[model samples]
Target chain A: DVKVTQSSRYLVKRTGEKVFLECVQDMDHENMFWYRQDPGLGLRLIYFSYDVKMKEKGDIPEGYSVSREKKERFSLILESASTNQTSMYLCASTTAGANTGELFFGEGSRLTVL
Target chain B: GESVGLHLPTLSVQEGDNSIINCAYSNSASDYFIWYKQESGKGPQFIIDIRSNMDKRQGQRVTVLLNKTVKHLSLQIAATQPGDSAVYFCAETGSGNTGKLIFGQGTTLQVKP
Candidate 1:
């Protein structure tokens, strides 16, 4: 079974604080993604990386950035957290050239910004 | 703008009965579609998927139907149980091999005994 592990399951941060969410997948999947899940909005992609040091903006990328320093590790960064940024963050990955549209997701990290 | 949407925000059904969830997509180029189930406090899990070349597909107790003419998609769950209660989301792959998926607002399924 493939496992995508998130560094934090729950986090609380004040406005203007920097936040970092880390994810690592055991499988050697080449693609990784960061998404924020909210009520009524479902899951909105923040950023995605197809290779190390390569990143692309998704539908909602205004308040987020991502880093893929290593193949298995992908990180999401919030330069300055805000109340509106409070939501559940999910990390997902799939094998390279996989067109099946199946993504293995992590358990998700719930972040609360005060 | 191209997007995927659900017909209902929630669906309630009695246990042992069949449940159906509907979805619509605006992009005609989308060829692959998927249905996911998200339990409370967990990430979405892949339930079933259908390709444009095929109109229907089944897995275990779940069946996915695609109607390209109407651009509609539906998931049917047989013998619904309490454990099947969760938020269901429909997603379509983006234009290319980008592996990006556009998801619809999920529909929450409630099972009654």
Candidate 2:
């Protein structure tokens, strides 16, 4: 089983503060993703990495950035957190694309920006 | 923009009954569809998936049906339990090797005992 671990379960930060959400996978998967889950707007991809030091912006990547310094570690960074950024953040990984494969997800991190 | 969407926002069914959740997608190029279940305070978990070449696929206690003509997807759960009560989202992927998924607006399922 692939284990994806997020650094925080709940996070609180003030507006304009820099925030970091970390995710690490034990399995040497080639793909990692960061998504934000909102009430009416399902899970929108924020960023995804196909390999170490490689990242791509997803649909909603305005207020967020990502890092994949290592194969097992992927990170989401909020350069300046805003109240609108308060939402549940999720981390996911897969050995490859959805060639009938599933994406293993971590327990989400709820961010509350004040 | 091409995206995935659900027909209903919520569905309530009696315990032990069957539940069907429907999803609509606008992207015809989407070759992969997946159903995910997210319980309270948790991330979405993979339930089942169907490829573009297949019409239906079955997993443990769950079945996914895909209609490529209409770009519609449905998830059927057998003997729905309280644990089956969760938000279900259907995802579609088009022309991507990064496993990038566009998720639908979720359908919340409630199983009453």
Isolated chain A TM-score, each model: 0.97, 0.95
Rate residue A62 of model 2 by lDDT: 99
> What TM-score, over all chains together, does every model reach?
0.98, 0.96
DockQ, every prediction: 0.77, 0.67
Clashing pairs in 2: none
Q: Among these predicted structures, which one has the highest DockQ?
A: 1
Off by over 4 Å in 1: none
**For residues B2-42, could you state the per-residue lDDT of candidate 2 as single tens digits?**
88999999999999999999999998888899999999877
The CA lDDT of each predicted structure is: 0.94, 0.91
Residue B4, model 1: lDDT of 93
Specify the highest-lDDT model's number. 1
Please report, as a residue range, the 10-residue window in candidate 2 chain A with the lowest summed lDDT.
A95-104
Model 1 docking category: medium
Clashes of each: 0, 0
Runs off by more than 4 Å, candidate 2: A97-100, B96-98
